[model samples]
Target: MRKKRGIVKRRETGIKYEISRKNLHYEKALDEIIRIFETENYRDRTINDYRRNWREFFKIIGKENVFDVTREDFRKYIRQRMQMDGLAAGTVNIRLGGVKSIFSRLVKEGILTENPGKDIPKLRTDEKPIFAFSDRQLKRLFSIIDKTSVAGYRDYVAMITMLYCGLRANEIENLEISDIDFDNSVIMLPGSKNKNRKIRAVPMNRKVREELRQLIIENQENFGEDVTHVFLTTFGEPIHHGLIRKRMHKYGKDAGLIDEARVSPHSLRHTFAIRYLKNGGDIRTLQMILGHSDITTTQVYLRYNNDDIIEQYNKATENDDLNL
Candidate 1:
């Protein structure tokens, strides 16, 4: 009876099981991929990223085996991703890369005969040239920030550290009380975006250091010494990027600093790079200071030099009296 019904029946236990063709294909590829993520054997979230891609790919392919997906299907996926207007180019690339990786893994496991995305070109998401502030502008901006006020002091120190140290918003958000090393004049950046474990030793400028010390003292008196966040919101929670950005806009308005481009928390880092370069700092040095894995990224600071050069050129040619 079991043989006629296409069921695998154990002779001793009399247990019968039927495996559908689609189920067999899914078991061979999709189930194993899911298991890889659930097991946590892959420590990175890369597995989860791939799994998400697989889920979306499967939904689109609809019961088609890994071997059945053609290049046309791959192109369609890319089109779908591009149509997501709110998604950044960087994020789209990540998702696309995730999809390619899954197919490559399937090919390695012999579940897929060929990777459809093997020859497909990767998406380009190279951002525009960075725009940072000048040293004079930075100093001027800080001059207007009153450190006597509690929130003002925090804002001043936060901006200074971010600009000077080139720390990312998320990295700054994760700072702990123990991370600061006043004796060494550095603050350790833990779990950075680059996944580097080494401590980023940033030189604590005197003014910034003094403000940070007073802020800590005040916090300790109010919330005690055990509190973790270096910068806090009014309710004493950790400061968010949104709030910091709002404060920056307000300060910019107050300082009469006008630029057509919109500024955000990330602008401070760019400002630091330009200021460092303007001060005659080398590109390699700036790269290390900014925690950039690639030197090419540090090269973007050169664009800011053009503005200074143009200013100088204007002054040099203006007095020549070429108005004839």
Candidate 2:
């Protein structure tokens, strides 16, 4: 007969465990997590995002073993990230999500008995009000773009597509000539940011159709059927997302928009959503237009104020004052 091992009881939760320690290396665990992301068909951009957040977390923990990280350690890491790095609550929450994903994978693979990040609470983040360009600002932005030059005309068309159809920068950059159904007055997006990865068909308004025709004419004249992407650089290559962001910022600044509000490519989407709502577009329809899987995501863009409500009410009761 052999001597029995004593059980260890955790003081915090009163949970009993056998005296056993697992040796799972942190780096190896992270590598496996990345492999899992790849197996799940996560986009390269999304994988890079997870890698960035997890690398930062590993640096903070300074541990080589995955099982060495305790719940307290995770809590302390969150506090350090917020206080020392001056990261906002929302940003920290995203980082926490990455950590949780890593630990969850490790647990699922039998590398760890429990996930330390499972009980880690996400920080409360105050939702920032949506920033959108007003009609005057939109006019100012369009007026500043010199439409005669090739790059200028490309940027103009790109901005107009985003403003009317709410296409993301990547969607616009990856757009092919075949995606535009000129006969049906619609633009087809094969891959969007939504979870389902379903194809989205957006209606082409007059402005979008006009700019698209112009872009097609310009592309035909310049590339002569060599390029496939709708938005191309001066070299006829597909435009990178970073350049589109920088161009949007430059145009926003030239139009005298506030820099603190982050008036960039995404602001055009916000502008489109708000304008659509104000012009009597329903939330359900806006959801479909924005390619959002959840209607709650679209609702975040609906920022109506009391003044707007009063204006609508006054318009409705304009002839029924009754002089009370």
Candidate closest to the true structure, highest lDDT: 2
lDDT of 2: 0.80
Give me the displacement of residue 148 in model 2, in angstroms.
0.7
lDDT of 1 by residue, 1-324 (tens): 464446554343232334343223433465565564466455355566776777786676565566567788777777776775456667767777877877786666554567888887877776766656655666667788888877887888788778877766666666666777887777766543333545565566676667677777887776777778888866677877577778877887777775643355688888777877887888987887777778887787887677789999999988796675
Q: Report every candidate's CA lDDT.
A: 0.69, 0.80
Candidate 2 off by > 4 Å: 1-21, 192-196, 259-261, 305-307, 310-324
Each prediction's total of clashing residue pairs, residues at least 3 apart in sequence or on different chains, is 2, 0
Q: Write the per-residue lDDT of candidate 2 for residues 53-166, one digit (tens) a residue.
A: 777787897877666788888887888998998999998898789789877876776556788888877888898877777777788888989999999999999998999998
RMSD of each: 5.7, 5.9
Cα error, candidate 1, residue 247 (Å): 4.4
